[model samples]
Target chain A: MSNKTITIDDIEVPFEEGQTIMDAALAAEIYIPHLCHKPGLSPHGSCKLCTVDVDGRAVSACTLPAAEGQRIDNNTPALNEVRKTITQMLFIEGNHLCPSCEKSGDCTLQAMAYHLGMLDGHFPQFYPQRELDASHPTLVLDRDRCILCELCVRASREYDGKDVFAISGRNTNRQLIVNSATGRLADSDIETDDMAAHICPVGAILIKDHGYEIPIGRRTFDLHSVAESDLGEIKLSNVRHHDE
Target chain B: MSKLRVGTTSLAGCFGCHMSFLDMDERIVGLLEHIEFTRSPINDIKHCEPCDIGLIEGGLCNADNVHVLQEFRENCKILIAVGACAINGGVPAMRNHFTLKQCLEEAFIDGIGVDNPHIPNDVEIPLLLSKVHPIHEVVKVDYYLPGCPPPADAFVKILTDLLEGREPSLPNEMLHYD
Candidate 1:
């Protein structure tokens, strides 16, 4: 543990010598909204929800290490507006019909939208025809709900050692693909207990027959706002799964 | 002060949003003191006359929806899209993934419970649009209140703000999309 402190949004928080701004902020019980960042997994910085102002320049907090006396702006109207736009883009890129979604309350994407006060998609729907892969006996993969955060890809490779998932293609054609002979999850070696199965931050990867097990009003985000939840601790446990 | 005129409608949706508006409960009695309904399903008005604000509660799925929405935009000084359906096509736009013909045939000719099924071609029926569209896709929406139907509190807050001549900005707790 280090005794050094860095200022974030004018609040002083101690940081280890090599801790990133996001890591330090989390250590101090502060949350910088993020989707692609899971502690202990290598930082992807893909979502940019954790982007913050440091020394008057916007930087991704997950990858930007905090230095002594560093001043970071984690929450601002403009930064939140940017995050909302990103969240909106993610919603439109997929057919995120939140009302009918099984992950309506538990999904981090939905939680972040609520945290940022997002009221609409604010963008045109791409209406991309994505497939729902129910080939697996225990899991359902609905590409329509995927935000391509790569949490599953990282979890499968780093934790489960299965290397079962990887993102493929480029730009709008980008999609999550199963590493199997038939490109079906059932054909893969992933089991119901795999970390990849539970690591998805969206409704894209779901364990069959497990949906709505916790009713909508009783789910995580329903009981507490994302900011109110112990999201840092949640990510810490997700990363801790790698050790077990 | 002149009473603010409000008009509302639901299209291509479940009318759950209008129900949420009604969820304002006793507050509706208070709201009536400052506002008047002109062309809402709540009052069963056939057409919109000039109004101060128009609240639309669904997406566009047919020509009639578009016609009514456009009329709202033209007749009202401000138009608000009041739910997920009106904001981003909500559940109705789920059909955007399939071809219009596929949806029609599945509902008419090939559905499991359909009896002597055929696509309706009656001149009296409004033709279904090729795709469902949010209110903004057809006409400009001046404001949006997102939610499956934004919380009853959201309706009260926004309406109260507008009635008092302030721009409506929902507090985070009042703004939800589920």
Candidate 2:
């Protein structure tokens, strides 16, 4: 590992030669808010929540490989406001029913909103008539909750090697797709054990017959804020631990 | 000095937000000394009288909700959207994706466990709007206390601030969404 250091929010975090700013910051136990970028997955930089100021230029930390003596501003009031706008956009673009959503406290998106002081969905909701695909016996695919982070698509292709999911459409209409000819999760080779099924940061891909098992107050975010929780373990863990 | 008059009501909500206000517990008892209920569910008042503050819970899903919200906006000097529902339509707005007709059909006819399912055709029931709307959409909302139902402390904080003639602001811990 090359011992190159970059300053993020005035804190010096050392990075390997190939490490991105996000990777470096995360390695140093410094949290940068993100939804799309996950460890062990190639940084897609789709969410853009990890946008950081490198000197005067704004760049996605997940994709921006750290160079020696780089000055990166990961936390700023202006950047946080921009992030809050993006979070509001995400909420308005889809039908986000946090109260009724099974993801609720466990959802990374919800946690990010809480972290950023996004007190409300300030934008007018599009409330698109997204499809809910329950064709899969063990999982429910509710498109209303999909943020189109494409984590499942990446996880399925990268980790499980099944290529079971992909994202189609563009702009506000972009959506998750099943690999099967029928365009249903039931026909796809995505088992509940697959990384694709577990990597969903939202309520879009939920396991059937396993909701509300953990009550509201005692769920993941209830115990520990998302910033403090081990995000890698939360996203990647196949086992259901109460601490998760 | 006269006690501050406060009015409150639930529009298209599940009353969870009101429950949070009630969760203030002993704080409400303390608040009663400085505030008086002019028009509120707690006092069983129908028409909202002029008040210093109006704490509105829920979204505008139907005509009745809109009417009540408009009345609150007009009658109160400051109107506060007191939960996720009032602030941004919350759970009720989830039905915005579907037509109002479709929603009614599903609820009254198409949904499972239906025996004598006929759409209710009573004049007593107010009509649902084409889409659910947040309180701000219907009328200007002065403040928003966000949460599925903001924690009991959130109610206390806002009430305390307002009662003390200060701008209501949520502390980091009280600004929860779910």
Candidate 3:
């Protein structure tokens, strides 16, 4: 392990060479709220949720390399307020009806909103009309809840070895599209067990028959905050046991 | 101590939120000691009188809803948007995805079971807005309590805090969208 260290909110965190600031923070069991970033997948800084102040400059922590003596601010009221607004934008941009949504308790977007203490969608809701694809035998893709995180896009290409999904268009017109000739998931190369099928951070992609199986209040985020639940899992499986 | 006047009304919402407010149950008897019902379903009051606090459930879907919400805003010193509908338009706002004409046609003309297939056009009926909107869009809301129907404890917390002259804030556990 490289001896290089950086200060996150004045706490010394060591990093290995080539490790991004996010990698270092996660390894140190520090939770930096993120949506588009998943470890082991090439970082796509689309969600902008993992933005941290690096040496007084705002940068995506997942892509920014950890340099020695770098002063980073991860958890601050000002930064959290910005993150809250970003989460709100994500909410308003989509028709995320959490009460009716199957992914309400398990959704990272909702968990992030809870973590940020977001009371309401602070801005005017765009309420853009989007489509829902139920053509797949075991999976459903509801674009109404998509936040353009690209996790499914990356997971399909890198992990599942099937580039079944890709984003099309640009700006407000941008949308998730299937790679199949019919422009449907059923016609695509994706399978029920594919990483891309299960990689959506929000309710955008969901399993067909397995929704609302776990009762409310017993689901993932209900048991613990996203920070505690995700970081604890990471600590248990990867960081502490592997380090030991 | 003079009892604080409280008003409540439900617009384009399922009365679930109002039911939850009543779910305060016996504690409501204790609440009555501090607050008096001014214009609420509990008292079967129609027009709102001047009140210390107004708890509004549901979103603005029609002209009547807008008028009632504006009256609440005008009469109440503090207006709290309660539950999912009042905060972010909730299930009622689902209609926002389609045009008002489409919704009316679907409900009246184009529906599978329709004995009388015509849009209801009556002088008594309030005109539907083009889009359903959260209460905050039509009027300034002092506080927002979010949930499908925020738990009874949440209502207690907000009311107790306001009654004590404190800023209304739900605990992390009490703060949920669904």
Scored by TM-score, the top model is: 3
Per-candidate TM-score against the hidden true structure: 0.95, 0.93, 0.95
**Tens digits of per-residue lDDT for model 1, B19-99:** 999999999999999999999889898988999999999899999999988999999999999888888888999899899
Model 2 lDDT at residue B133? 86
DockQ-based ranking: 3, 1, 2
State how far residue A95 of model 1 sits from its true place (Å).
1.1
Candidate 3 local distance difference test against the native: 0.88
lDDT of each prediction vs. the true structure? 0.87, 0.84, 0.88
Per-residue CA lDDT of model 3 for B1-178, tens digit only, reads 9999999999988989999998989999999899998999988999899999999999888999999999999999999999888888889888888999899999999999898799999999999989888888878889989888999999999999999989888899998888
DockQ for all candidate structures vs. native: 0.72, 0.68, 0.74
Model 2 is docked with a DockQ of 0.68
TM-score of chain B of 1: 0.98
Pick the winner on lDDT between candidates 2 and 3. 3
| Residue B4 CA displacement from its true place in model 2, Å | 1.9
Per-residue lDDT of candidate 2, residues A109-157 (tens digit): 8888888877767777677877889999889999988999988998898
For candidate 1 chain B, the 10 contiguous residues with the lowest summed lDDT are B169-178
Predicted candidate 1 versus true structure: per-residue lDDT over A174-226, tens digit per residue:
99999999999999999988889988888998888878677776777887888
Q: How would you encode candidate 3's per-residue C-alpha lDDT over A22-130 as one tens digit per residue?
A: 9899989999999888888899988888999988899999999899899999999989999999999999899887888899888889999999999888777787888
Q: Which regions of candidate 2 are displaced past 4 Å?
A: A230-244, B109-118
